[model samples]
Target: MGFRHTLRDDKLYFYERRDIMEQRHNYLKKIRQYRREDRPIVYLDETWANSHMAPERLWLDEQGRGGWKRPSGKGQRLIILHAGSETGWTPNADLVFRSKKNSTDYHDEMNSEHFLEWFQKLLVNIQPGSVIVLDNAPYHNSVVEKVPTKSSRKKEMQEWLTRKRIPFSDKDLKKDLFAKIQLSVPNRKLYATNEAAKACGHIVLRSPVAHCELNPIELVWADVKRYLKVHNKTFKLADLEQLVPDAFQSVTPEMWAKHCQHVQEEEERFWEKDGLQEESVEEYIIELGTEDDDDDIEVRDIEFEGEGEDSDGEQDECEPVMDENDRELLRSDAVSDA
Candidate 1:
């Protein structure tokens, strides 16, 4: 059986890698199209940390003998933090609370209760009716298994959100204080809404799978990890605990804006480096055709067979190939065939 599998693997190994790469290229192109049409891309991901003392070891002349010296007392606990952001430079984060505890509680603190509260705050901060993209994590999508005989936490939270419109900012102020209130009750337009909890004038967008490039948070993580490596390489768990906040502080709005500008330049450089033309205003006008030229060209969806080309490790799909001969031939062919 192993021999047969090996034989099959040998046959597979002989196949061109480009064929497999092309599939991925097409997939990414479709996703990019969706994103361009969709506004406010949001990214959600998890980060881990341990409570144990930092491991210490000296570099030895010996080969591969490094070992961990387990520390006595408590190990590290996992905290799940969810963050969302828009293209327009707005961001918000919520730490999940696990209702129940384990040997080491890896869940959020308030679980359902806290999640709703945090979500409400996050939504209100971003403004209502804005689209938010998030990852398909269990915490985001997991349906709380309810006890048939008892009320589930999920049901309770849902009921509360539905009936209650929490006041923004100050709790002491009356709910009817906002000028945009409809009659006595506050306008639904004032608060943010999630995919789970739908309300008036709210849009929630789910992030595309396997497409980290679309998420601005990827840049945030890159900056974060870079900051940690350069600033906190020798730091302990306690040091890290302090370092995290400091590191975040270091990444000010100015720094983030600079990073984003750098990203745009880098993207342009990449295309230029790969001998691909940077997308221009003229190109969009030429490709999509002018809005006034309704009779010149008909706009309709057609199944385009994407031809991908290699650019470093990633496949570049939908690269506009400027071939005058090909364009003329295609036009001529259409005219003759018609």
Candidate 2:
């Protein structure tokens, strides 16, 4: 039996044994529909924390007329984590960043040199031209627009910022606010106009709406937060200043699989209760080239691992092909948001 407190009725409602089983049945059905796909599916999400010690006065107004107006101290840490299929994918692969001070003392949070480096490093390790479904984050949106364009560089194109009365500041333009503004800027389709078209190959496509459900990796984070809550631990901004990979070592593949299985089962039960059919999950596996499956375990291990592989085994079975025009359109993204 389970009991839940309701704010609407101002009373506690109790569920008998049958009620609990029925609720679980519905949840399991939902999970099966979401994770049952042949293509790879992953979920992405973000979390952040401000300075470790939040001043009490900062939360409460001194005048006793109002609540705390601003954060007491300066400092913040932001983290991004991605999870794929319940049984597969690595654990706690998080990208972390730290702020100099409090929320009000804003610095360049997005598109900074550091942010670019972090993204570039991640891209290098990913399968070239693999599809990476992401939300409408500013960093992913303005990559092409921010890149110097041919017309602007050659004085052949109109400086849109100048015509729009927008002052250009390499510094301010690099800030998060600039990204917010760029997201609203009309698509110019500059990827076609830029020289660095290959860069866009790293991003796959955007996920559909109401479809965090479609992302198999989303459950990894749901479990992560739950685990943290049980431990009663608060993250400190200073902790993020260190190499993030080390800090995240505590999250192992075994732990992630455990959580993934739990979430998958729970969701499946939910869908069944609702009498809904299960949706198939997408697989990331692609026939990137051919290799003899009979190769020794040592050869197979190297290819599967992030280590160097044998020359004969390294060639892709299906290398991505792109024409100049398509490359430009993809780089500029003037036509499609993907």
Candidate 3:
């Protein structure tokens, strides 16, 4: 009875966290390298402005507790894509999409094509020697069709290898019996945004997964919500659309500077801490301060619902489905049978 075994708690995703830190270190090195070159770096991200979003309570006084009810309706929301940088917010580089619910019952969303269109604008307007920071969303990291992991290429795969100038051919190259051939090469040019950025004479920097603290835009979002909450009296979609522009415009350049500086400090802190997630972080306060998220407010995926056809505009995975033709090809036997 005295000899009882003790159970220990397991650390979930321990190895995964370490891998993420390793990624952080590598990215930080790249960032520092860019900084030394005097290349401007801008952090980019997308967020949803929901119609049902607003404050839930009031500051309670010793004399009385204050509570209020806000009107509700089926209001639409818009998905806005914005960017911020060290200098300040980029002028003439924000996109807004009317998010409507599609037949799939989800929300119409921003996919790779939409992002790429905006990204083209971003590249054009941004300064030379600039690094556009992004999360590891699939779209941002989209690249040319990677070589398939096969010994020989289909007509298309063969063409890709030739175009990429990868030296591997059943004719030009020989393989040992024990060894295998690989048409697919790792570390090849990433597709979509990465490839596009490089082609446009800009750099694409990606934040590590699970490291939200590294993006100043996250803090900017909190401020935007606080602004919306303060002015959101009637939860109407039309008003929300109008308020969104106001909310974003309300973000002063000083706030952007503070948030960006805070992100750099967080990067340094993360490095000093050797990748361990901090129990506490000194938060960057907005000019309007912050608001408490209502406990009843349901947190959904980033894309807000509107009235439209169902789509895979999921920002969570941020996967880009290049174009309609590409999508069809992937679905067809051309690539699948291969």
Query: Which predicted model would earn the best lDDT?
Result: 3
lDDT of 1 by residue, 1-338 (tens): 45332211211221123432232233333334434655443444444334443324434547865544445543443343555443333455635222234432233332344455666656655645455554323344322232111122334433333455633333322222322122433221111224333553444443322233444555665455445445544335555556555545555666555554554464344334434432322101111221111222222211111112211111111222334653565567558856
What are the lDDT figures for the candidates, one per model? 0.38, 0.37, 0.59
TM-score of each: 0.40, 0.39, 0.65
Instruction: Tell me how candidate 3 scores on lDDT.
Output: 0.59
Mark the 10 consecutive residues where model 2 has the least summed lDDT.
298-307
Residue range 1-338, candidate 2, lDDT tens digits = 69555432100111122443333343334333333433233334444333332223323356666533333443354444443444455344356565543432122244424444444544444444443444333333333344223223322122444555655554443343344345546543322112121474543443321223434455444344334323322344444334344334445667656665665564555455456554433421111111212111111111111011112122111112234653464457534533
Q: Judge candidate 1 at residue 138 and give its lDDT.
A: 30
By summed lDDT, the worst window of 10 consecutive residues in model 3 runs over 283-292
Q: Which segments of model 3 are wrong by more than 4 Å?
A: 1-16, 59-68, 71-75, 102-108, 149-181, 184-187, 275-338
Ranking by lDDT: 3, 1, 2
